[model samples]
Target chain A: MDKLRQHIEDITALSDEEYAYIKTFFTAKKVRKGQYLLSEGDDARYEYLVLSGIYKVFYIDEQGREFILQFAKENWWMSDYEAFFREKKATVFIECIDAGEVLVNTLQTREKLATEFHKMEHFYRAKLTNGYIALQQRIKLLLSSTPQERYETFSKMYPDLGQRLPKKIIAEYLGVSRETLSRLYSR
Target chain B: MDKLRQHIEDITALSDEEYAYIKTFFTAKKVRKGQYLLSEGDDARYEYLVLSGIYKVFYIDEQGREFILQFAKENWWMSDYEAFFREKKATVFIECIDAGEVLVNTLQTREKLATEFHKMEHFYRAKLTNGYIALQQRIKLLLSSTPQERYETFSKMYPDLGQRLPKKIIAEYLGVSRETLSRLYSR
Candidate 1:
């Protein structure tokens, strides 16, 4: 797709012929809101690049408490990555928050493309670098920031998300109670 | 730099000449225990690949409480990654827990190597892939696991590290009080 082309080109340029060949590896899928892309114990066979909507990657604890790990938006990637990369059964769930299409690629394709195209390898490394930084930032936030500080950081970092997501989800992401989130909101 | 060669070879094969050229980009340094490899406000110019020794990458909160983000052992990588990649002032501290040697690498070197050698690109990508998976595991633990569960996971993941690290530091890493860690240790 043109979108997939644009996404890869944003990291490393590819010729029209190269793009055509590379694009063959990805398959498009339409997802409805509330549909599950991945569930615990399922084989995580593919990783997704969102074309249009929001999604959440989460895990459920023994007591059935759900904890959100991260959100995926348009142009973002999402998967139960541990399972996807290691070929292990999924320990997390990926659910569609808003209906949209995503382009899916399997591990075999990722390896084949990278092995064939040096530029593709470069593209993947670049993306991983950014993802690594983001996860580090999240760890720092989780380890130290106060609840109010977290709310402020979250709103600042994802202004659109803050406005669009339910406050309940926002509170869960921040590791705060609904009442605490309400107090912060009133301020 | 045989260690460096072996590290790369573990992910992808390289010719002798290629390995020689690639090794030039890395410089080895001997670190002393208690010395700080990186500190808040430093430029975070290099990422370190441990050859021998232990290191902690951490941050101090406004309340002056230290929070450990991660520990680096032999074959592990450590850096103020946000600052390393973004070229920003460091916001974290990297301190040596045991004196030993490490291979230090610059961003310029990493980018040059990856761009010049496709194998190098694949090598870096593979390493980042593992790093990303480990960070995801950390996030999952932080969000849901109980202290006892976290302790068990940590011990199982790093049996040697469990024996070597001070319980205080282990407690910090697990987000548990030292007393809680002591209780876990007793059991």
Candidate 2:
């Protein structure tokens, strides 16, 4: 609860009343390693904020190759974001890479909180802005950065996550082959 | 201005006073085909709302291969969003694909509108949510869809954009070769 409160404050200054109101929406869940948080084609009803452990968001391609989109660690949020926000079917599978605890909230609960509390709405809007900005940076990196540069940069950006995930998972997220990543690392 | 008003209305219901306040922030600009509204390394201080024509938001790789991130048509917004919202240097270029007109608003003006009009903030927040959802969908498509399927789906999703932009441009946006796109289109 302290971490959640701190997370909200780090993004935007939240009043105590606003924080309490926002807190009502979240329910804690413990997920075991290899358990599914969200499956492809499921309705994504909840957004998750990791309290502990690691989770991977990925999809199986036409050739049945798994491509990792992102990994979430403690304090980070994870969801089949499109489906969760747009009321659509999930297009990615969110799996617990390690046994983890997370705070989960449904979209309806979030909207209710936002409507009932102006400060909460402002806080959420700021978080959304940050999320959107971060996504834009990632897209730019994808376009402009070489795989090696991306690996180096990713290491710098999220060293903890980089160390926790397997080499192949990181390789796929960087849009490189495991073989290519190995070669880059060796060099 | 009419299109801009309609665009705002599509996202959120705005009172006349709110609309008038927003109207003061927007300055119109005429863009020629192939001209840039934004470029890499420049500061993105303003958001552009298209009133007429089409624009491509793209980044160039080291090999000088252009990757289109998105296309904006009538009533659509185009900018180096990462820079615009985050106050960072732009990493993408927004190029007009046809002679066009757009409404430009500086970040400062946007902040004022948000402070002075709650409804305006809600309107922008809705717009951000929509963009965030679309980007998430793009990430899902990149992870799950075959190149041919992606091209087909993109055509279905933005038929107007497909018709307006060159096939080569569309291919890059879909992360495929022009030859591969030609092969798929022929089928």
Which regions in candidate 1 have their CA more than 4 angstroms from the true location? Answer: none
The recovered share of true contacts, given per candidate in order, is 0.80, 0.33
TM-score of every candidate relative to the true structure: 0.97, 0.91
Residues B19-82 of candidate 2: C-alpha lDDT, one tens digit per residue: 7868988999999998998889999988998888888888887788888888888877778776
Q: What's model 1's lDDT at B88?
A: 98
| TM-score, predicted candidate 1 vs. hidden true structure | 0.97
Residue pairs in steric clash, candidate 2?
none
Query: Candidate 2 falls in which docking quality class?
Result: acceptable
What is the i-RMS of every prediction?
Answer: 0.8, 2.2
What is the TM-score of each candidate's chain B when compared with the real chain B?
0.97, 0.94
Off by over 4 Å in 2: A143-146
TM-score of chain A of 1: 0.97
Best prediction by DockQ: 1
Candidate achieving the largest TM-score: 1
Candidate 1 root-mean-square deviation in Å: 1.5
